[model samples]
Target: MKNQSLACAEFSESQIHALIHLLSDPDHHIAQTIHDQLVSIGHPALPLLGLAERNQENPILLDRLSSVIADIRFTDVEHAFQALTTSSTEEVNLEAGAFLIARTAYPDLEVQSYQRQIEDIANILKQRCEPGLAPRQAIQTINQHMFVELGFKGNIQDYYNPNNSFLHQVLDHRIGIPISLSVLYLLIAQRLNVPVVGVGMPGHFMVRLKAEPVFIDCFNQGVVLSEKDCAKFLDKYGVDFDSHYLDPVSNNQILARMIRNLVAIYQKRDESNLAEQFTRLLNIVEPRE
Candidate 1:
Protein backbone atom coordinates (compact mmCIF):
# COMPACT_ATOMS: atom_id res chain seq x y z
CA MET A 1 0.00 0.00 0.00
CA LYS A 2 2.37 2.70 -1.10
CA ASN A 3 1.06 6.19 -0.53
CA GLN A 4 1.18 8.75 -3.33
CA SER A 5 3.84 10.76 -1.55
CA LEU A 6 6.08 7.74 -1.10
CA ALA A 7 5.47 6.52 -4.60
CA CYS A 8 6.48 9.73 -6.31
CA ALA A 9 9.04 11.07 -3.79
CA GLU A 10 11.92 10.55 -6.17
CA PHE A 11 10.51 11.10 -9.64
CA SER A 12 12.94 12.59 -12.14
CA GLU A 13 12.32 14.95 -15.04
CA SER A 14 12.51 12.02 -17.43
CA GLN A 15 9.94 10.20 -15.31
CA ILE A 16 7.54 13.13 -15.58
CA HIS A 17 8.05 13.43 -19.31
CA ALA A 18 7.61 9.70 -19.57
CA LEU A 19 4.35 9.90 -17.64
CA ILE A 20 2.94 12.65 -19.85
CA HIS A 21 3.08 10.21 -22.71
CA LEU A 22 2.07 7.23 -20.57
CA LEU A 23 -0.80 9.06 -18.87
CA SER A 24 -3.28 8.10 -21.54
CA ASP A 25 -6.74 9.16 -20.26
CA PRO A 26 -7.59 5.69 -18.97
CA ASP A 27 -4.75 5.70 -16.39
CA HIS A 28 -6.51 8.36 -14.37
CA HIS A 29 -9.09 5.77 -13.22
CA ILE A 30 -6.34 3.92 -11.37
CA ALA A 31 -4.99 4.75 -7.89
CA GLN A 32 -3.45 7.80 -6.27
CA THR A 33 0.02 6.28 -6.41
CA ILE A 34 -0.16 6.23 -10.19
CA HIS A 35 -1.56 9.73 -9.97
CA ASP A 36 1.16 10.62 -7.47
CA GLN A 37 3.81 9.10 -9.64
CA LEU A 38 2.60 11.35 -12.42
CA VAL A 39 2.50 14.42 -10.16
CA SER A 40 5.92 13.59 -8.79
CA ILE A 41 7.17 13.50 -12.36
CA GLY A 42 7.47 17.27 -12.62
CA HIS A 43 5.47 20.41 -12.04
CA PRO A 44 5.20 20.96 -15.80
CA ALA A 45 2.93 17.94 -16.18
CA LEU A 46 0.99 18.50 -12.93
CA PRO A 47 -1.24 21.24 -14.34
CA LEU A 48 -2.23 19.14 -17.32
CA LEU A 49 -2.80 16.04 -15.22
CA GLY A 50 -4.69 18.10 -12.65
CA LEU A 51 -6.90 19.71 -15.27
CA ALA A 52 -7.56 16.35 -16.86
CA GLU A 53 -8.39 14.79 -13.51
CA ARG A 54 -10.71 17.65 -12.64
CA ASN A 55 -12.75 17.01 -15.77
CA GLN A 56 -12.79 13.28 -15.27
CA GLU A 57 -16.50 12.81 -15.82
CA ASN A 58 -16.97 15.53 -18.37
CA PRO A 59 -17.71 13.83 -21.68
CA ILE A 60 -16.73 16.92 -23.61
CA LEU A 61 -13.41 17.06 -21.83
CA LEU A 62 -12.88 13.38 -22.54
CA ASP A 63 -13.48 13.88 -26.26
CA ARG A 64 -11.17 16.86 -26.36
CA LEU A 65 -8.46 15.01 -24.50
CA SER A 66 -8.84 12.05 -26.80
CA SER A 67 -8.49 14.43 -29.71
CA VAL A 68 -5.37 15.96 -28.19
CA ILE A 69 -3.84 12.54 -27.69
CA ALA A 70 -4.65 11.65 -31.27
CA ASP A 71 -2.67 14.63 -32.44
CA ILE A 72 0.44 13.81 -30.47
CA ARG A 73 3.21 11.90 -32.21
CA PHE A 74 3.41 8.67 -30.26
CA THR A 75 7.10 7.84 -30.14
CA ASP A 76 7.93 4.73 -28.18
CA VAL A 77 4.52 4.90 -26.45
CA GLU A 78 6.33 5.29 -23.07
CA HIS A 79 4.58 2.94 -20.62
CA ALA A 80 2.08 2.19 -23.38
CA PHE A 81 -1.55 3.40 -23.43
CA GLN A 82 -2.92 0.16 -22.00
CA ALA A 83 -0.79 0.56 -18.83
CA LEU A 84 -2.41 3.87 -18.00
CA THR A 85 -5.90 2.88 -19.15
CA THR A 86 -7.08 -0.49 -17.86
CA SER A 87 -7.47 -1.99 -14.35
CA SER A 88 -5.10 -4.70 -15.50
CA THR A 89 -2.06 -3.28 -17.34
CA GLU A 90 -1.61 -6.35 -19.49
CA GLU A 91 -3.16 -5.55 -22.93
CA VAL A 92 -0.85 -4.67 -25.77
CA ASN A 93 -1.50 -1.66 -27.98
CA LEU A 94 -3.34 -3.41 -30.77
CA GLU A 95 -4.66 -0.06 -31.88
CA ALA A 96 -1.24 1.45 -32.40
CA GLY A 97 -1.59 1.44 -36.17
CA ALA A 98 -5.37 1.82 -36.19
CA PHE A 99 -7.59 4.88 -36.27
CA LEU A 100 -8.66 6.89 -33.24
CA ILE A 101 -12.43 7.20 -33.54
CA ALA A 102 -14.41 4.12 -34.37
CA ARG A 103 -17.29 4.83 -36.74
CA THR A 104 -20.77 3.61 -35.79
CA ALA A 105 -21.95 0.69 -37.89
CA TYR A 106 -25.22 -0.36 -36.22
CA PRO A 107 -26.72 3.14 -36.41
CA ASP A 108 -27.13 5.09 -33.16
CA LEU A 109 -30.61 3.64 -32.59
CA GLU A 110 -29.24 0.13 -32.84
CA VAL A 111 -27.22 0.78 -29.73
CA GLN A 112 -30.59 0.68 -28.00
CA SER A 113 -31.07 -2.75 -29.49
CA TYR A 114 -28.04 -3.91 -27.56
CA GLN A 115 -29.60 -2.53 -24.41
CA ARG A 116 -32.94 -4.17 -25.14
CA GLN A 117 -31.34 -7.54 -25.73
CA ILE A 118 -29.45 -7.09 -22.48
CA GLU A 119 -32.70 -6.68 -20.55
CA ASP A 120 -34.29 -9.68 -22.23
CA ILE A 121 -31.35 -11.89 -21.34
CA ALA A 122 -31.56 -10.70 -17.74
CA ASN A 123 -35.22 -11.68 -17.41
CA ILE A 124 -34.56 -15.17 -18.73
CA LEU A 125 -31.49 -15.66 -16.53
CA LYS A 126 -33.46 -14.43 -13.51
CA GLN A 127 -35.87 -17.31 -13.91
CA ARG A 128 -32.98 -19.77 -13.63
CA CYS A 129 -30.96 -18.02 -10.92
CA GLU A 130 -31.78 -18.07 -7.24
CA PRO A 131 -32.68 -14.54 -6.20
CA GLY A 132 -29.81 -14.26 -3.73
CA LEU A 133 -27.06 -16.15 -5.45
CA ALA A 134 -23.56 -14.72 -5.02
CA PRO A 135 -21.83 -13.53 -8.16
CA ARG A 136 -19.49 -16.49 -8.51
CA GLN A 137 -22.15 -19.01 -7.58
CA ALA A 138 -24.63 -17.63 -10.06
CA ILE A 139 -21.99 -17.65 -12.76
CA GLN A 140 -21.18 -21.26 -11.95
CA THR A 141 -24.79 -22.30 -12.13
CA ILE A 142 -25.30 -20.61 -15.49
CA ASN A 143 -22.16 -22.19 -16.88
CA GLN A 144 -22.96 -25.67 -15.67
CA HIS A 145 -26.57 -25.68 -16.74
CA MET A 146 -26.57 -23.54 -19.89
CA PHE A 147 -23.21 -23.17 -21.58
CA VAL A 148 -21.50 -26.40 -20.69
CA GLU A 149 -24.11 -29.03 -20.01
CA LEU A 150 -26.57 -27.77 -22.55
CA GLY A 151 -23.81 -26.98 -25.07
CA PHE A 152 -24.82 -23.56 -26.32
CA LYS A 153 -23.10 -22.86 -29.61
CA GLY A 154 -23.01 -19.61 -31.60
CA ASN A 155 -23.58 -20.74 -35.14
CA ILE A 156 -23.15 -17.88 -37.63
CA GLN A 157 -26.44 -18.61 -39.33
CA ASP A 158 -28.44 -17.81 -36.20
CA TYR A 159 -26.91 -14.34 -36.26
CA TYR A 160 -28.65 -13.83 -39.59
CA ASN A 161 -31.79 -15.78 -38.79
CA PRO A 162 -34.79 -13.44 -38.77
CA ASN A 163 -37.66 -15.54 -37.44
CA ASN A 164 -35.75 -17.26 -34.62
CA SER A 165 -36.08 -15.93 -31.11
CA PHE A 166 -32.94 -14.00 -30.25
CA LEU A 167 -33.01 -15.48 -26.74
CA HIS A 168 -33.39 -19.02 -28.00
CA GLN A 169 -30.83 -18.44 -30.72
CA VAL A 170 -28.36 -17.21 -28.13
CA LEU A 171 -28.91 -20.25 -25.91
CA ASP A 172 -28.35 -22.57 -28.83
CA HIS A 173 -25.33 -20.72 -30.35
CA ARG A 174 -27.24 -19.45 -33.36
CA ILE A 175 -26.03 -15.95 -32.47
CA GLY A 176 -22.44 -17.14 -32.46
CA ILE A 177 -19.70 -15.45 -30.69
CA PRO A 178 -18.56 -12.43 -28.91
CA ILE A 179 -21.87 -10.58 -29.12
CA SER A 180 -24.00 -13.34 -27.63
CA LEU A 181 -21.52 -14.09 -24.85
CA SER A 182 -21.08 -10.41 -24.14
CA VAL A 183 -24.82 -9.90 -23.83
CA LEU A 184 -25.26 -13.05 -21.79
CA TYR A 185 -22.56 -12.24 -19.23
CA LEU A 186 -23.74 -8.69 -18.71
CA LEU A 187 -27.37 -9.65 -18.23
CA ILE A 188 -26.73 -12.58 -15.89
CA ALA A 189 -24.22 -10.64 -13.80
CA GLN A 190 -26.64 -7.77 -13.41
CA ARG A 191 -28.93 -10.18 -11.57
CA LEU A 192 -26.16 -11.13 -9.15
CA ASN A 193 -24.80 -7.59 -8.70
CA VAL A 194 -21.38 -8.48 -10.07
CA PRO A 195 -19.71 -5.78 -12.12
CA VAL A 196 -18.03 -8.05 -14.61
CA VAL A 197 -17.49 -6.44 -18.04
CA GLY A 198 -16.66 -7.56 -21.55
CA VAL A 199 -13.65 -7.14 -23.81
CA GLY A 200 -13.54 -7.99 -27.51
CA MET A 201 -10.51 -10.22 -27.86
CA PRO A 202 -8.58 -10.26 -31.12
CA GLY A 203 -9.91 -12.89 -33.52
CA HIS A 204 -12.28 -13.81 -30.69
CA PHE A 205 -15.04 -12.17 -28.71
CA MET A 206 -14.66 -12.83 -24.96
CA VAL A 207 -15.92 -11.70 -21.54
CA ARG A 208 -13.93 -10.27 -18.64
CA LEU A 209 -15.15 -11.11 -15.13
CA LYS A 210 -13.83 -8.98 -12.27
CA ALA A 211 -12.22 -11.59 -10.06
CA GLU A 212 -9.77 -11.07 -7.23
CA PRO A 213 -6.17 -10.58 -8.43
CA VAL A 214 -7.36 -10.61 -12.08
CA PHE A 215 -10.17 -10.36 -14.65
CA ILE A 216 -11.26 -13.68 -16.18
CA ASP A 217 -12.31 -15.24 -19.51
CA CYS A 218 -16.03 -15.86 -18.94
CA PHE A 219 -16.80 -16.53 -22.64
CA ASN A 220 -15.38 -19.97 -21.98
CA GLN A 221 -18.39 -20.60 -19.72
CA GLY A 222 -17.56 -19.39 -16.19
CA VAL A 223 -14.32 -21.32 -16.32
CA VAL A 224 -12.37 -18.41 -14.78
CA LEU A 225 -9.45 -19.65 -16.84
CA SER A 226 -6.27 -17.76 -17.73
CA GLU A 227 -4.67 -16.84 -21.09
CA LYS A 228 -3.03 -20.26 -21.01
CA ASP A 229 -6.37 -21.81 -21.70
CA CYS A 230 -6.77 -19.37 -24.54
CA ALA A 231 -3.54 -20.61 -25.99
CA LYS A 232 -4.59 -24.21 -25.53
CA PHE A 233 -7.92 -23.59 -27.22
CA LEU A 234 -6.18 -22.03 -30.18
CA ASP A 235 -3.78 -24.96 -30.34
CA LYS A 236 -6.71 -27.33 -30.58
CA TYR A 237 -7.85 -25.43 -33.65
CA GLY A 238 -4.29 -25.42 -35.04
CA VAL A 239 -4.17 -21.64 -34.67
CA ASP A 240 -1.06 -20.08 -33.15
CA PHE A 241 -2.50 -18.34 -30.10
CA ASP A 242 0.98 -17.74 -28.71
CA SER A 243 1.73 -15.21 -31.41
CA HIS A 244 -0.93 -12.91 -29.93
CA TYR A 245 -1.86 -14.32 -26.50
CA LEU A 246 1.23 -12.72 -25.02
CA ASP A 247 -0.16 -11.60 -21.63
CA PRO A 248 -3.24 -11.33 -19.46
CA VAL A 249 -5.49 -8.61 -20.88
CA SER A 250 -6.96 -5.43 -19.45
CA ASN A 251 -10.61 -4.29 -19.81
CA ASN A 252 -9.81 -2.34 -22.94
CA GLN A 253 -7.95 -5.40 -24.15
CA ILE A 254 -11.09 -7.48 -23.83
CA LEU A 255 -13.16 -4.88 -25.64
CA ALA A 256 -10.52 -4.90 -28.29
CA ARG A 257 -10.88 -8.66 -28.34
CA MET A 258 -14.61 -8.34 -28.92
CA ILE A 259 -14.15 -5.81 -31.66
CA ARG A 260 -11.50 -7.99 -33.18
CA ASN A 261 -13.88 -10.93 -33.20
CA LEU A 262 -16.43 -8.91 -35.09
CA VAL A 263 -13.80 -7.46 -37.36
CA ALA A 264 -12.46 -10.87 -38.27
CA ILE A 265 -15.87 -12.25 -38.95
CA TYR A 266 -16.87 -9.23 -40.98
CA GLN A 267 -13.62 -9.27 -42.86
CA LYS A 268 -14.11 -12.92 -43.65
CA ARG A 269 -17.56 -12.02 -44.90
CA ASP A 270 -16.08 -8.98 -46.73
CA GLU A 271 -17.67 -6.21 -44.73
CA SER A 272 -14.57 -4.03 -44.72
CA ASN A 273 -15.95 -0.86 -43.14
CA LEU A 274 -17.70 -2.67 -40.32
CA ALA A 275 -14.45 -4.40 -39.51
CA GLU A 276 -12.77 -1.03 -39.30
CA GLN A 277 -15.39 0.41 -36.99
CA PHE A 278 -15.25 -2.54 -34.61
CA THR A 279 -11.47 -2.29 -34.57
CA ARG A 280 -11.88 1.23 -33.31
CA LEU A 281 -14.36 0.12 -30.62
CA LEU A 282 -11.82 -2.36 -29.41
CA ASN A 283 -9.82 0.59 -28.16
CA ILE A 284 -12.71 2.33 -26.42
CA VAL A 285 -14.10 0.02 -23.68
CA GLU A 286 -10.99 -0.75 -21.71
CA PRO A 287 -11.37 -1.40 -17.95
CA ARG A 288 -8.90 0.38 -15.71
CA GLU A 289 -8.76 -0.12 -11.96
Candidate 2:
Protein backbone atom coordinates (compact mmCIF):
# COMPACT_ATOMS: atom_id res chain seq x y z
CA MET A 1 0.00 0.00 0.00
CA LYS A 2 2.88 2.35 0.85
CA ASN A 3 4.55 1.73 -2.49
CA GLN A 4 1.22 2.19 -4.30
CA SER A 5 0.68 5.49 -2.53
CA LEU A 6 4.20 6.60 -3.37
CA ALA A 7 3.67 5.66 -7.01
CA CYS A 8 0.45 7.66 -7.11
CA ALA A 9 2.20 10.64 -5.51
CA GLU A 10 4.99 10.54 -8.10
CA PHE A 11 2.54 11.43 -10.91
CA SER A 12 2.62 15.21 -11.56
CA GLU A 13 -0.49 17.21 -12.48
CA SER A 14 0.58 17.17 -16.15
CA GLN A 15 0.96 13.41 -16.03
CA ILE A 16 -2.53 13.05 -14.47
CA HIS A 17 -3.92 15.28 -17.21
CA ALA A 18 -2.32 13.13 -19.90
CA LEU A 19 -3.63 9.95 -18.22
CA ILE A 20 -7.16 11.36 -18.32
CA HIS A 21 -6.85 11.38 -22.10
CA LEU A 22 -5.77 7.74 -22.01
CA LEU A 23 -9.28 6.91 -20.85
CA SER A 24 -10.24 7.31 -24.51
CA ASP A 25 -7.61 4.82 -25.67
CA PRO A 26 -8.83 2.44 -28.38
CA ASP A 27 -7.40 -0.72 -26.78
CA HIS A 28 -9.83 -2.02 -24.12
CA HIS A 29 -7.08 -3.48 -21.92
CA ILE A 30 -5.02 -0.27 -22.00
CA ALA A 31 -8.07 1.88 -21.28
CA GLN A 32 -9.03 -0.40 -18.37
CA THR A 33 -5.52 -0.20 -16.97
CA ILE A 34 -5.67 3.58 -17.17
CA HIS A 35 -9.00 3.54 -15.36
CA ASP A 36 -7.56 1.40 -12.58
CA GLN A 37 -4.48 3.60 -12.27
CA LEU A 38 -6.60 6.72 -12.06
CA VAL A 39 -8.78 5.19 -9.37
CA SER A 40 -5.72 4.06 -7.46
CA ILE A 41 -4.48 7.64 -7.49
CA GLY A 42 -7.78 8.33 -5.65
CA HIS A 43 -8.94 11.86 -4.77
CA PRO A 44 -6.05 13.58 -6.49
CA ALA A 45 -7.33 12.32 -9.83
CA LEU A 46 -10.91 13.57 -9.35
CA PRO A 47 -10.36 17.15 -10.51
CA LEU A 48 -8.52 16.08 -13.65
CA LEU A 49 -11.15 13.47 -14.33
CA GLY A 50 -13.94 16.02 -13.80
CA LEU A 51 -12.29 18.41 -16.26
CA ALA A 52 -11.93 15.63 -18.79
CA GLU A 53 -15.53 14.60 -18.25
CA ARG A 54 -16.66 18.15 -18.92
CA ASN A 55 -14.52 18.73 -22.01
CA GLN A 56 -14.43 15.24 -23.54
CA GLU A 57 -16.60 14.85 -26.64
CA ASN A 58 -16.67 11.06 -26.64
CA PRO A 59 -19.81 9.62 -25.01
CA ILE A 60 -17.98 6.38 -24.13
CA LEU A 61 -15.25 8.16 -22.18
CA LEU A 62 -17.86 10.25 -20.35
CA ASP A 63 -19.62 7.09 -19.20
CA ARG A 64 -16.34 5.60 -17.98
CA LEU A 65 -15.45 8.71 -16.01
CA SER A 66 -18.91 8.77 -14.46
CA SER A 67 -18.47 5.17 -13.32
CA VAL A 68 -15.13 5.95 -11.70
CA ILE A 69 -16.61 8.99 -9.92
CA ALA A 70 -19.51 6.87 -8.69
CA ASP A 71 -17.12 4.23 -7.37
CA ILE A 72 -15.20 6.85 -5.40
CA ARG A 73 -18.40 8.29 -3.94
CA PHE A 74 -19.54 4.80 -2.96
CA THR A 75 -16.27 4.28 -1.11
CA ASP A 76 -16.94 7.43 0.90
CA VAL A 77 -20.46 6.24 1.78
CA GLU A 78 -19.10 2.79 2.75
CA HIS A 79 -16.64 4.36 5.17
CA ALA A 80 -19.30 6.62 6.67
CA PHE A 81 -21.62 3.66 7.27
CA GLN A 82 -18.73 1.67 8.76
CA ALA A 83 -18.22 4.40 11.34
CA LEU A 84 -21.95 4.41 12.14
CA THR A 85 -21.97 0.66 12.68
CA THR A 86 -18.76 0.57 14.73
CA SER A 87 -19.48 3.60 16.87
CA SER A 88 -19.84 3.28 20.65
CA THR A 89 -23.16 5.13 20.55
CA GLU A 90 -26.18 3.19 21.71
CA GLU A 91 -28.52 4.44 19.00
CA VAL A 92 -27.84 5.13 15.36
CA ASN A 93 -29.01 8.45 13.94
CA LEU A 94 -31.75 7.26 11.60
CA GLU A 95 -32.00 10.59 9.75
CA ALA A 96 -28.26 10.62 9.10
CA GLY A 97 -28.32 6.98 8.04
CA ALA A 98 -31.14 7.63 5.59
CA PHE A 99 -29.33 10.57 3.99
CA LEU A 100 -26.07 8.62 3.75
CA ILE A 101 -27.88 5.85 1.89
CA ALA A 102 -29.51 8.41 -0.38
CA ARG A 103 -26.11 9.91 -1.14
CA THR A 104 -25.05 6.64 -2.75
CA ALA A 105 -27.24 7.63 -5.70
CA TYR A 106 -27.36 11.41 -5.16
CA PRO A 107 -23.74 12.23 -4.54
CA ASP A 108 -24.41 15.97 -4.52
CA LEU A 109 -27.26 15.89 -1.98
CA GLU A 110 -27.11 18.76 0.49
CA VAL A 111 -27.87 17.07 3.82
CA GLN A 112 -28.34 20.29 5.76
CA SER A 113 -31.00 21.39 3.29
CA TYR A 114 -33.07 18.33 4.12
CA GLN A 115 -32.41 18.74 7.83
CA ARG A 116 -33.82 22.24 7.66
CA GLN A 117 -36.84 20.99 5.78
CA ILE A 118 -37.61 18.48 8.51
CA GLU A 119 -37.03 21.10 11.18
CA ASP A 120 -39.41 23.42 9.38
CA ILE A 121 -42.09 20.75 9.38
CA ALA A 122 -41.58 20.22 13.07
CA ASN A 123 -41.86 23.92 13.71
CA ILE A 124 -45.12 24.08 11.84
CA LEU A 125 -46.51 21.22 13.88
CA LYS A 126 -45.38 22.95 17.05
CA GLN A 127 -47.31 26.05 16.05
CA ARG A 128 -50.40 24.03 15.21
CA CYS A 129 -50.65 22.11 18.46
CA GLU A 130 -52.27 23.92 21.36
CA PRO A 131 -50.71 23.84 24.82
CA GLY A 132 -51.69 20.88 27.00
CA LEU A 133 -53.61 19.28 24.14
CA ALA A 134 -54.57 15.65 24.57
CA PRO A 135 -52.24 13.15 22.96
CA ARG A 136 -54.95 11.96 20.60
CA GLN A 137 -55.81 15.52 19.64
CA ALA A 138 -52.17 16.38 19.15
CA ILE A 139 -51.82 13.40 16.86
CA GLN A 140 -54.86 14.49 14.89
CA THR A 141 -53.43 17.94 14.50
CA ILE A 142 -50.21 16.43 13.14
CA ASN A 143 -52.18 14.27 10.75
CA GLN A 144 -54.10 17.23 9.41
CA HIS A 145 -50.95 19.28 9.01
CA MET A 146 -48.89 16.52 7.42
CA PHE A 147 -51.42 14.62 5.37
CA VAL A 148 -54.27 16.98 4.56
CA GLU A 149 -52.66 20.38 4.53
CA LEU A 150 -49.18 19.49 3.34
CA GLY A 151 -50.49 16.82 0.95
CA PHE A 152 -48.19 13.98 1.95
CA LYS A 153 -49.47 10.60 0.92
CA GLY A 154 -48.51 7.10 -0.17
CA ASN A 155 -47.32 6.73 -3.74
CA ILE A 156 -49.67 3.91 -4.61
CA GLN A 157 -49.21 4.42 -8.35
CA ASP A 158 -45.43 4.07 -8.27
CA TYR A 159 -44.85 2.49 -4.90
CA TYR A 160 -41.83 0.58 -6.12
CA ASN A 161 -39.84 3.59 -7.27
CA PRO A 162 -36.51 3.75 -5.38
CA ASN A 163 -37.09 7.46 -4.81
CA ASN A 164 -39.71 6.48 -2.24
CA SER A 165 -36.87 5.21 -0.06
CA PHE A 166 -35.14 8.55 0.18
CA LEU A 167 -36.22 11.02 2.86
CA HIS A 168 -35.35 14.06 0.79
CA GLN A 169 -37.45 12.85 -2.10
CA VAL A 170 -40.25 11.90 0.25
CA LEU A 171 -40.23 15.43 1.65
CA ASP A 172 -39.81 17.14 -1.67
CA HIS A 173 -42.45 15.09 -3.42
CA ARG A 174 -44.80 14.45 -0.47
CA ILE A 175 -45.15 10.81 -1.52
CA GLY A 176 -43.44 7.66 -0.31
CA ILE A 177 -43.84 3.99 0.51
CA PRO A 178 -44.61 2.86 4.05
CA ILE A 179 -41.17 2.78 5.72
CA SER A 180 -39.83 6.04 4.35
CA LEU A 181 -43.00 7.92 5.19
CA SER A 182 -43.03 6.29 8.60
CA VAL A 183 -39.48 7.52 9.21
CA LEU A 184 -40.48 11.01 8.15
CA TYR A 185 -43.48 10.95 10.46
CA LEU A 186 -41.43 9.53 13.31
CA LEU A 187 -38.78 12.20 12.94
CA ILE A 188 -41.24 15.06 12.91
CA ALA A 189 -43.50 13.59 15.61
CA GLN A 190 -40.58 12.87 17.88
CA ARG A 191 -39.29 16.38 17.40
CA LEU A 192 -42.66 17.71 18.63
CA ASN A 193 -42.27 15.56 21.77
CA VAL A 194 -45.05 13.25 20.63
CA PRO A 195 -44.78 9.69 21.94
CA VAL A 196 -44.84 8.20 18.44
CA VAL A 197 -42.55 5.30 17.52
CA GLY A 198 -42.18 3.26 14.33
CA VAL A 199 -44.03 -0.06 14.17
CA GLY A 200 -42.44 -2.23 11.49
CA MET A 201 -45.35 -4.55 10.86
CA PRO A 202 -45.03 -7.41 8.44
CA GLY A 203 -45.41 -6.15 4.86
CA HIS A 204 -46.34 -2.72 6.18
CA PHE A 205 -44.99 0.09 8.35
CA MET A 206 -46.76 2.50 10.73
CA VAL A 207 -46.28 4.51 13.90
CA ARG A 208 -47.96 4.45 17.28
CA LEU A 209 -47.74 6.42 20.46
CA LYS A 210 -46.01 4.57 23.28
CA ALA A 211 -48.64 2.62 25.16
CA GLU A 212 -51.34 4.20 23.06
CA PRO A 213 -54.45 2.55 21.67
CA VAL A 214 -54.00 3.78 18.07
CA PHE A 215 -51.54 3.21 15.26
CA ILE A 216 -50.81 6.03 12.78
CA ASP A 217 -50.49 4.80 9.22
CA CYS A 218 -48.55 7.60 7.56
CA PHE A 219 -48.86 5.99 4.15
CA ASN A 220 -52.63 6.00 4.57
CA GLN A 221 -52.83 9.64 5.56
CA GLY A 222 -52.24 8.93 9.23
CA VAL A 223 -55.28 6.67 9.47
CA VAL A 224 -55.69 5.48 13.03
CA LEU A 225 -55.85 1.72 13.47
CA SER A 226 -56.44 -0.42 16.52
CA GLU A 227 -54.37 -3.46 17.44
CA LYS A 228 -57.01 -5.74 16.01
CA ASP A 229 -57.13 -3.63 12.86
CA CYS A 230 -53.39 -3.99 12.51
CA ALA A 231 -53.73 -7.77 12.83
CA LYS A 232 -56.53 -7.80 10.29
CA PHE A 233 -54.44 -5.77 7.87
CA LEU A 234 -51.59 -8.25 8.25
CA ASP A 235 -53.99 -11.13 7.69
CA LYS A 236 -55.44 -9.38 4.64
CA TYR A 237 -51.99 -9.28 3.16
CA GLY A 238 -51.61 -13.03 3.89
CA VAL A 239 -48.90 -12.30 6.38
CA ASP A 240 -49.25 -14.30 9.56
CA PHE A 241 -49.99 -12.10 12.51
CA ASP A 242 -47.08 -11.79 14.94
CA SER A 243 -47.53 -9.70 18.05
CA HIS A 244 -43.83 -8.87 17.98
CA TYR A 245 -44.27 -7.29 14.57
CA LEU A 246 -46.04 -4.38 16.23
CA ASP A 247 -43.08 -3.65 18.44
CA PRO A 248 -41.17 -0.43 17.84
CA VAL A 249 -38.09 -0.95 15.74
CA SER A 250 -34.74 0.50 16.71
CA ASN A 251 -33.09 3.13 14.53
CA ASN A 252 -30.72 0.50 13.16
CA GLN A 253 -33.65 -1.71 12.26
CA ILE A 254 -35.35 1.19 10.48
CA LEU A 255 -32.24 1.92 8.45
CA ALA A 256 -31.91 -1.75 7.56
CA ARG A 257 -35.51 -1.91 6.38
CA MET A 258 -35.07 1.19 4.22
CA ILE A 259 -32.03 -0.32 2.51
CA ARG A 260 -33.76 -3.67 2.09
CA ASN A 261 -36.68 -1.87 0.44
CA LEU A 262 -34.32 -0.24 -2.06
CA VAL A 263 -32.67 -3.59 -2.74
CA ALA A 264 -36.01 -5.16 -3.57
CA ILE A 265 -37.06 -2.23 -5.74
CA TYR A 266 -33.82 -2.30 -7.76
CA GLN A 267 -33.96 -6.07 -8.05
CA LYS A 268 -37.44 -5.95 -9.52
CA ARG A 269 -36.25 -3.41 -12.09
CA ASP A 270 -33.25 -5.68 -12.88
CA GLU A 271 -30.90 -2.94 -11.78
CA SER A 272 -28.32 -5.35 -10.46
CA ASN A 273 -25.71 -2.70 -9.79
CA LEU A 274 -28.02 -0.71 -7.50
CA ALA A 275 -29.36 -3.87 -5.88
CA GLU A 276 -25.81 -5.00 -5.10
CA GLN A 277 -24.87 -1.63 -3.65
CA PHE A 278 -27.80 -1.53 -1.18
CA THR A 279 -27.38 -5.21 -0.34
CA ARG A 280 -23.75 -4.60 0.64
CA LEU A 281 -24.85 -1.57 2.67
CA LEU A 282 -27.55 -3.61 4.40
CA ASN A 283 -24.93 -6.13 5.45
CA ILE A 284 -22.80 -3.37 6.91
CA VAL A 285 -25.63 -1.54 8.64
CA GLU A 286 -27.40 -4.65 9.95
CA PRO A 287 -24.89 -7.48 9.95
CA ARG A 288 -26.63 -10.72 10.91
CA GLU A 289 -23.68 -13.06 10.38
The best candidate in terms of TM-score? 2
lDDT of 1 by residue, 211-282 (tens): 522234444454565666667766877777653343334534444444555566677878664555455455
TM-score versus the correct structure, for each prediction: 0.40, 0.91
- Which residue pairs in candidate 2 collide? none
Looking at candidate 1, what is the lDDT of residue 170? 54
Cα error, residue 281 of model 1, in Å, equals 5.1
Q: How high a TM-score does candidate 2 get?
A: 0.91
The C-alpha RMSD in Å for every predicted model, in order, reads 14.9, 2.4
Candidate 2 C-alpha error for residue 106, in Å: 0.7
- lDDT of each candidate versus the true structure: 0.47, 0.87
Worst 10 residues of 2 by lDDT: 1-10
